[model samples]
Target: MERKVLEVINLKKHYKGNKAVDGISFHLNAGEIVGLTGPNGAGKTTTIKCILGLLRKTKGRILVDGMDSTKQESKYKLAYIPETPDIYPMLTVWEHLKFIALAYYIDNWQEYGSEILKRFDLWDKKDSLGRDLSKGMRQKLSICCALLHKPDVFLVDEPLVGLDPKAIRELKDAFKALRAEGKSLLISTHMLDTAEGLCDRIVVLKKGTLIMEGTIEDLRHKVNAGEDTSLEDLFLEVTEDEKE
Candidate 1:
């Protein structure tokens, strides 16, 4: 049986009588990439923050490799890439990589770090400070940092946001490579077509509630869509509140 790398059961987040995430459950297994997608305000970010232990959940359980997500040890087993790349303005690209390497106690990270920078086309900017880099470069650097230690699972939010076409292709290939190596991934994004082609399964949320979870074909069937229907069409049908 494949091991569950990430699990969220009955997860809920309530703030001042406002329910951001209301009891949603999902799981990602080793070697699989699941898309956590929905329209804006669908609680995708909240769910991710909760799972990453950035926000305390009002009620629920999140397990990372079967360990409680609130534990520091559990955090070491996974990585996260938020929508906005957070990097130190004073740190150079290479310095950022070194920081992650040292923090994780990774021996001989130079070769791996160089390889990652090259793969993301940021090798030429290794000496550039974070503040000097463009949005796309910063995003790439953030991805490289998150991947430096190679955790068991990845929680990537809007990974393709600032990437150029080439960078986007490279990042998608990287995700596949991680899956090939038995690592799991949970991706959240509004790019339905990319998510459609890359993910094995998708979980959709609406107004803090999970409304659908399944493969592309399964979702089409659920929405009574034609065989040729695209994921965007299916999503529209599923999330529409004005359906006749």
Candidate 2:
């Protein structure tokens, strides 16, 4: 059997007196795409931070490819695209690509970089300084850097915010291509339509607690919703019940 690409057990993260993520757990197998979603302040980003080892977890464990994510502290095999593109003001777009490719030890970076830039419609701006690119273009550059490595897992946070319609279509296609290569994706986004269209499974949270998780059909049934229920409707139904 293919080993689980990622696993989380009783994951929790607390800040001061409040819990940002509370005892929520899930797993993603190779080729699976899971959408981690909820409203603002719902612990979606918090859980993502714990997985990336950016924020220390208060409790529980996360294993990537059966390796302890905390102890082993593996860096590669996972690629992350944050909500904001982290770019150096001085580096040209091509420079950024060279830096990321070197960090991942991928030779023939010129060849790989061109492919990504072309795919994201960013090739024309290859010589532009990072600070000079448009927001959408910058975001595409960030994605290009991550994909140059071809990591086993891709973790993205609200990736659709700055994308134009064409860019959005391109990104969705890229994710599909990666999944076809047996990669796993754990994406945290508030765009319900994209989540509904893209994810193989959906995991929802409210105030740090897991309120719903499963395939779309499974989640709909869990809430006794209609078979054709939309994710937006199901989310409202599930979250509304939590308030009562």
Candidate 3:
């Protein structure tokens, strides 16, 4: 059996009257990419943050490589690239990489970091301060930082947003390469078409609840959709209900 790199069991996060992430469960295997997708306010981000331990979950458990996600060892095995890149305005593009290296205790990261920068088309902007880079550039820099540590699992939110065509292509290739290296990725995205091609499987959320989870073919079967039905169409069909 394939090893599970990440697992969320009966996960939930609730505010005073809001069920941001109702009971949901999913697991990501090593060398796999699972897309977490749905319309706005669907709890996609909440689920990810819960796994990252950024926001406390009101119920349920999270595991990283079979260890409690709150453990230091588990944290070291994870990396996250949020939808909105939160880079230090005072740090240069290259400085950000250096900081990650220091935090992760990665030795000889210069060569690898240089190659990553080149791959993402950020080598030329290495000296540019984070505040000076555009949204796209900042996003690229955030990816580079996340990659430098070579974590076992990656949580990427809206990864394709703010990226140019070439950057988008490069990021897609990088995702494939990471999978090849036995890394697991949980990608939260609204870009259904992109997710269809890239993800090994998908987990759909609605009103903080998991509505669907399966391979494309499996999802098609669940909805009785024909072979050519796109993920977008399938999503609309499953989430057509007005009431939660």
Candidate 4:
């Protein structure tokens, strides 16, 4: 059996009168890539925030590596990339990587840094300040920072928002490499095409509730769609079911 990297049981997050994450639950396995998706106001971001412990869940459980996130901080075992890039605008690329290495307490960062930067096509701007880089470049820098620690679980939100075609391809390869290294990911995105290519499984959410969760093939079957039907089509089916 695949090792469970993360799990949420009847997870609920209340924002005043709104039940932002209304009793949604799911589990992710090691080496698995799970896409969390839905239309706007579907609670995708809220669920991610709850998983990261950035927002407290009103009820139920969120277990990361078998540790209750509220009781213990196991953040060192995981990495998170929010919907928007959040890196120091004043820091140079090399300095940001160095800061990450220190934060992760990894001493042998010189070789690792070079390899990752080159893979992301960021070697040329290694000394560029974050404030001066293009949107795509800055996104790459955040991605590099997230991976520099080489944690077991990655939580990414809207990772492709600013990436170019080539950079997107590099990112796909990088995610595959991370999975090959026995890492798992929980990605939240509205980009169906990218999610279809990268996710091993998927979970659909609508109005703060889970609509479906399964492998791509399994999801296709659940939607009663043909094997060739795209994720976008299947997404429509799931959310439509929620509407009715």
Candidate 5:
């Protein structure tokens, strides 16, 4: 049996009358990559934040590595890469990795950090301050910081947005490598092509609710699409009625 590394059960978050996340449930098993894709305002970020315990959920449960997400130990078991790269403006690239290591109490993180930095093409900018880096470089640094911890589960949001082609390839390779190491990944992305190729299963959300969850073939079956039907087309078919 596959071990479940992350689980969200009937999760919900509300702001007065606005329901940002509404009873969405999903699980990511060890070594699996699950893509969370949806239209804007479909509650992707909100759901991630809830799982990260950055936001208090109005209702439901979240488990990280089989422990309640609210537990302090659970925090150490998962790492998050947000849609926006939030870095310390005054801190240099290397300093960011150092901070993550210290925060996660990860010993011997230097070699691993250096390796990831080189892979992301940020080795030369190790001495550069965060504010001095371009959008893509900042994104790269954020990924390095998250990777330095070697967490069991990774929550990635918009991972390919600002990446150059080389960096994008490296990130994709890293994802596979991590999976081989038995790490679970929950990737929330708007890039259908990336999801189609990289994710083992796809979860689609609409208006803060889960509309579908399954493999690409399962999705095709759900929509009665042909074998050649792309994820983008399947996504459009499901969401087109929402615009009406």
Candidate 6:
């Protein structure tokens, strides 16, 4: 059996009386990419933050590589890219890579760092400080940092938000390569088409509850949608009650 990279069991988070995440559970297996999607206010971000230990969970268990996710050791095996890229303003593009390498204790990282810069078309901006880069460049830099250590699992939120067409294509290609190497990924995005094409399975949330989980075909079957039904339509049909 494939090793489970991450497992969330009966996870819950709440504020006052608002249940941001209400007893949701799922797992990402080695080499699998699972899409976590939901409408606005559906608890997607809360779920992710809980898993990352950014927010204290109201209840539940999160295991990363068979260890408690809140533990420091588990963090070493995980990487995250949020909707907005956060980088040190004084650090040059190249410095960011070096910083990551040192933090991850990567030996002989120079060649790999250089290759990553070139792959993302950021070689020419290597000396540019983070403050000098545009939104797209900043996003690219974030991607570079996240992948530099080659973590066992990746949790990306709105990864394509600021990427240009070329960067988008390159990032997608990189994700495919990571999967080929047996890394698990959990992608959270509002872009249904991208998720539909990239994910092995999808977990949907509505008002802090998991409404569905399955492949595109499996989802179509769950909703009684035709085989040709698009994910966008499926999502709409499943979450239509939210807007009512």
lDDT of each candidate versus the true structure: 0.89, 0.87, 0.91, 0.85, 0.89, 0.88
lDDT of 3 by residue, 1-244 (tens): 9999899999989999799999999999999999999988999999999898899999999999999998988988899988789899999999999999998889999999999899878999999999998777787788789889778999999988877887778778878987887989999998899899999999999889999899999999999999999999999988885354
Task: Tell how far residue 214 is off in model 1, in angstroms.
Answer: 0.9
For every candidate, C-alpha RMSD to the true structure in Å:
2.1, 1.8, 2.1, 1.9, 2.1, 2.0
For candidate 4, what's the RMSD?
1.9
lDDT tens string, model 5, 52-167?
98999999999998899999989888888887888999999999999988877889988998898987789999999999987667776877888786689989999898778876
Q: What is the lDDT of residue 207 in candidate 4?
A: 83
Q: For candidate 3, what is the lDDT?
A: 0.91
Cα deviation in Å at residue 111, candidate 1? Answer: 3.1
Which structure is stronger by TM-score: 1 or 6? 6
> Candidate 3, which ten residues in sequence have the lowest lDDT sum?
235-244
> Which lDDT tens digits does candidate 1 get at residues 101-220?
898999999999999899878999999999998776777788789889888888889889867887778678878877887989899987889899899999988889998899999998
Q: Which residue pairs does candidate 2 place in steric collision?
A: none
Model 2: which ten-residue window has the lowest total lDDT? 70-79
Clashes of 1: 0
Off by over 4 Å in 1: 241-244
Candidate 3 TM-score versus the reference: 0.91
Off by over 4 Å in 4: 71-73, 104-108
List model 4 lDDT by residue over 1-244, tens digit each: 7799899899998888898889998998999899998878889988888888888789999888898877646777778987678878899999999999887788989899998899888999998888998777777788789888777788998888777887788777877877888889898988888888999998988889888888889989987899899989998877767668
Cα lDDT, model 4, residue 125 = 91
Top-TM-score candidate index = 2
